[model samples]
Target: MEKRNQSAITEFLLLGFGDLHNFKILVFTLFLIVHIMALTANVLVIVLVGVTRSLHSPMYFFLSQLSLSELLFTSDIVPNMLWLILVGGGRVSVARCIAQFHILCIPSAAQCLLLAAMSFDRHIAICRPLHYATMMTVTRQLQVVTSCWLLGVILALFLYTFLRKLQFCDLNTIDHFYCDVAPLLQLSCSSTCTVELAVAMVTYPLLLSPFIFIIVTYICIIRTILKIPSSTGRHKAFSTCSSHLIIVCTYYGTLTFIYLFPPTDNSIELHKGLSVLYTLVTPLFNPLIYSLRNQEIRAAIFNYIQSFKKWKAEK
Candidate 1:
């Protein structure tokens, strides 16, 4: 009965980059631009923090790690996706899809955890200003970051093992731009309840816990800001949080829209649009979000440009 009713999905057909034969290059160019922007911005953030002596603090250090993860996370999807849309066929083999899922999924979850850690750092600075340096010591930040990476890898392992057992029997076409959990699981002919339960066990905490942490941290931050009794003080505190809130809202809003609701017929178009934003747009926005007001990254880029100019003159 199991084999009779269930036909395994050998591969998945990803419907992405739209269907204009002539515009394929244009679409590829757009994605390529986003990719290059993401890579350069993220790598610059990492290098700026890593090489700069003044940036050897808890906040900048964590930001560097996040940059590294985002680099890996976006690279896994966008490059392969661009190849599929621009030149190669969009069909992904089962094995390849499985690998992509694990790689993409882990970092996605880890980003949420890392964001929560960042929020905590800010909360300490805002709420308990006197103890900020001591509380957010380098050792503590390292532990937080290390924990996020470990949890991400472990959750990915569980997802891979759990997904391996399920049999996919329905249509091969994936509606979203990328290989997402819910959409991929939709085609399963076998027991999805197991997959659902196991996944919830791993994912719900990663997503929701961070949300809760951010909320709590900000609540304290806001309270502390209120007690400051000075307009300039309040404004500076608010400005610090505004950037992170924007990023959190953008990332979590799109992610929740796709993952929270059931895949109703009306959601198909919305899902595709949101997937593009979450995957590509976030990569574009992360550096802008974290680095624009950041003097360290700006100085790092300036120094690099100066060196390159001098080297050219020497040559």
Candidate 2:
């Protein structure tokens, strides 16, 4: 019976901001621009970090990895969102929905680990500057980044193992944009106790542990900064990690609200709004925040522009 029911529903109708009938075109245009800008900005960051010898440190390496993850994250969701806006919601096959969820989860999980690693890097750079070089060597940087990606893949697969077992019956409408865990579970007819439990087990630790780790790491960083004899030194040290701290707060804040609090029937719209913040707006802002705030990134961009101009003149 469950098998038959699951087989009956081949597709789900994602009700993505369908209520914004008056603003659909406006919203679509905005999202399209955001998507393009996010892709361009992240790509630019990755390219600069890759090509610029000055950005070859562990911090910049992690930044490039972050750009890669954001690039993938936005690519996975924003285009679908644009389509939804244009068509006023869209039909997605069950398989496609599942794939979307996994793709989304992989970056999300990787980002969590990556942020923690970044915080640890800052901690070492600030708190133990003398050993920073030996500690965060090129080989160790690769190991840490590889671990983040590998663990992300493992975690997503673990969730997929349980999610694939869920059976959806007659209902095929997902309230929010894309195939999120909460909405999919709500749509399923099967007893989702195990699935819900699995999600909680995975989500709480994945989110909280890293969050706690980052908090503790930042505390140490702050202490180190405070101890700096000169105000300039303190400001310089703080500047090094401020962009990352902002990204961490924004990313975790929105994610916590969406996942930990799971939306009530009345709050689905609010949920979608917060989802947009993290999914669309956050990625768009990340590269901008880093580039605008960090002197090194600005210098890299300026140098590249000069090089381009000289090349064109020679040609």
Candidate 3:
């Protein structure tokens, strides 16, 4: 019976916003623009960090890694989402769905850890400025970035293994746009107690712990900035981390609301809307936030533009 049930289901019907028949074209156009903007913004950050000597510090290095992660995260989910919006959702093979989940989870997990690391970088820059150079050396930066990605890969694999074990009987209709954990678990015919437990174990440490660390670090940072005596010094110190703080709040806030407080049937649409914020909007906002708020990034961009114009004139 179990074998037959498992064999009977091989695909899922993703009913993505099928009810919004009139707004399909509008939604598709908006998502396409956002997707292109996100890709362009992240790629610009990556290229600037790689080629620009001014952005060689630990902070910018982490920002570049973040852009790279956002690139992967957005690329994995957005195109499919756009397609679903255009077609009013469609069928996706079980294997393809699981693969999408794997790809999405990896970068999502990595970004959580990476944000924590960025907070630490800010903490050191503000709270322990004298030791910043020594603490955040090139080798240490590499280690931190490598660990985030490696742990992310491990976590994704662990979840994938458990997900593979679940049987998906006759019911395979997922109302959501993507293969998120909650929707997938709801569809599974097999017992999901173990999977839920595993997810909780991973989520608490990966999500909550980092969030707590960021909060604690910011508290210390705030206290230190307050003691700087000069208003200029305080403002400068606060500015260094303000962008990171904003991103952290937005990212963790949505994630907490989504994962910590599971959505009810009535709130599923709201849940999907919030998912779009972090998945689509956040990536577009990241580079913009940094570019607008960080003086160094703006200066770098301006210098590059001038240099490009000069080269063109010479040619």
Candidate 4:
């Protein structure tokens, strides 16, 4: 019985939307549209940032990096999710499941650190405008972005390496849409107490530390904005910072609940719904938010469109 159980789960069957089996086609169509739109939006942002000389600032630079990360992040999940929804249920090899889990965590962890760094960038720009140029030099901006990616990859690997050692026996059906650390661990037959502890320890510093840092930075930003007697200046300052704040709140708020809390059998469905907010909705809306909120982004997009039209006319 023990050997049979051990051999039972060489692959995982993702039970996606079992409750909505009747609406699989609709679900697949909706997801497909979202996936395409997300890719197009992020790619447009990347191109605009790269080509537009006027957008060559620290804020836009960080935004472009974020767009790139969002591209990879959604790519890691949506394609597989689309397939599963269209095909009803599908099998994923054990190795592929592990890889998927790692890929999902990489961009997410990077976004956490990147948002923190962006907050710091805004803090210096708004609070210490005099020294912003010297303090956040282009070289330093590159270094900060590099560190976000490096730290995210290193820490995600640490969690993945630890998870890889754990033995999964018999239980292989993942209840959620995709492979995630919590759901995967829940499927493990062995007691995951030690691994969970290690994950929690890493998760706190990665997620909460940056979150608290952002909060503190925002406090300083708000204070600085208030000191400006001119209401117009205050509105301008608020506009610049508000987008990041909105993105941060939306991304981190859901993430905190998902990662910081222990997963329970009762909350699996709830967790899955919340995961959609951060994983799909956040990335989907990021480009839209920036494009709509930032005048500079809008101007660049407008110029790019006009240039494309001229080129087509000439062709």
Off by over 4 Å in 3: 1-7
Candidate 3 lDDT over residue span 80-149, tens digit each: 8888888778999888898898888899899999999999998999888899999999999999999999
Would you list the C-alpha lDDT of every candidate in the order shown? 0.81, 0.91, 0.90, 0.86
Q: Tens digit of lDDT per residue, candidate 1, span 52-169?
A: 7877877778788778888888888887778778754578876777788889987888888888888998898888889998888778888899999999999999999988776776
Error in Å for residue 144 of model 2: 0.5
Q: Whole-model lDDT, candidate 4?
A: 0.86
TM-score of 4: 0.95
Backbone clash total for model 4 is 0
Q: In model 4, where do residues sit more than 4 Å from their true spots?
A: 1-8
Cα deviation of 10, candidate 2, in Å: 1.4
Residue lDDT tens for model 4, 117-164: 999999999999999999989999999999989887998898888888
- Relative to the unseen true structure, what is the C-alpha lDDT of residue 251 in candidate 4, on a scale of 0 to 100? 89
**What's the ranking of the predictions by TM-score, best on top?**
2, 3, 4, 1
Candidate 3 lDDT score relative to the true structure:
0.90
| Cand. 1 TM to true fold | 0.91
Instruction: Tell me the lDDT of model 1 at 306.
Output: 98
Query: What ranges in model 2 sit over 4 Å off?
Result: 1-7
Per-residue error (Å), model 1, residue 128:
1.4
Enumerate residue pairs that collide in model 1: none
- Residue by residue across 1-315, what tens digits does model 2's lDDT show? 133344568899998888677888888888888889999999999999999999999998999999899998988998888888888888999888988999999999999999999999999999998999999999999999999999999989988989988878888998878899988888788878888888888899999999999999999999889999999998899899999999999999999999999899899889989999889999989899999999999999999999999999999
- What is residue 178's positional error in candidate 1, in angstroms? 2.6
